[model samples]
Target: MKIIRSRDFTGSHAWEALDIASMNGITTRLHWTDQPYRWHVNDGEEVFVVLDGEIQMRYRENGQEQVAVLKVGDIFYASVGTEHVAHPLGVARVLVVESKGSV
Candidate 1:
């Protein structure tokens, strides 16, 4: 068993992550970022949880672009084939769960 303080985590680069756990082909990770992630579709489903700070989540739907402001405790679910990206307002910590090796 392990305990993590999300607010105490930081990375040397954007989107750097701490591997938390892996179960049944899925992986849970804690990420620290001050930059945006590239827009891409996951191979499977993805669950994004804001642990600290805020994020501007941009996604595509029906060929249109949309955005959602996600703050602490907010969660974003991305199903297969869903294209999305995350832009942090500043330094942010996020918990992400998705299939192993998913992009």
Candidate 2:
């Protein structure tokens, strides 16, 4: 058993992550970043939760770009075929759950 503090997390580089678990082929991770992630669609689904700081989640919908500002405690669900990316406003800690080995 481990007690984790989201606000106290850090990474060696942008989007660096600490693996939390892998169950049923789904991987859970804690990520720390101050940079934007590349746009990509998950093979299955993705759950993005902000633990600290904020982020602008940008995605393509109906051929148009959309943005959602996510604060701490906010959760964003990306269904399959959703082309999206995350831009951290600052040092942000995020919890991400997705299929194992997914980019």
Candidate 3:
């Protein structure tokens, strides 16, 4: 087992992730970002948890785009075929749980 301090983490680039665990084709990772991510659809389900700072989560539903502001401790769930992207307000740390190679 390993202990991680999410607030103390940083990445070389936006959306760079540190792998935390993988079990039964599911992967858990920590991501650091200060920029926005491109919109994309996941092949499977995804669980996004904010660890530090804030994020503006944009998603497309029924051909419409919507946004949600997520703060620390907030969780966002994305099911298969859900097109979404994340825009961090500044520097943010996030924990993401999803199927292996789902991106």
Candidate 4:
């Protein structure tokens, strides 16, 4: 068993993640970032939870770009084929759960 204090986590680069656990083919990770992630589609579904700070989540739907403001405690769900990116308002910690090896 392990205990993690998400607010206390930091990384040297954007989107650097700390592996938490893996079950079946899925993995859970804690990420720290102050920059935006490149747009990409996950190989499977994804669950993004904001642990601290705020994020501007951008996505494309029906060929139109959209954005969502995700604050601490907000959750974002991305289904397969959903092209999306995350832009942190500042330093942020996020918990992400998705298939192993997914980008």
Q: After superposition, how far is residue 79 of candidate 3 from its true place, in Å?
A: 0.8
Residue pairs in collision within model 1:
none
In model 1, where do residues sit more than 4 Å from their true spots?
none
lDDT of 1 by residue, 13-98 (tens): 99999999999999999999999999999999999999999999999999999999999999999999999999999999999999
TM, every model = 0.99, 0.97, 0.97, 0.98
Q: How many residue pairs clash in each candidate at the backbone level?
A: 0, 0, 0, 0
Q: Candidate 2, after superposition: displacement of residue 69 in Å?
A: 0.4
Q: Write the per-residue lDDT of candidate 4 for residues 14-85, one digit (tens) a residue.
A: 999999999999999999999999999999999999999999999999999999999999999999999999
Q: Write down the lDDT that model 4 would get.
A: 0.98
Residue 24, candidate 3: C-alpha displacement in angstroms: 0.2
| Candidate 3 structure quality by residue, lDDT tens digits, 45-67 | 99999999999999999999999
lDDT of each: 0.98, 0.95, 0.96, 0.98
**Which residue pairs overlap in candidate 4's backbone?**
none
Candidate 3: RMSD to truth: 0.6
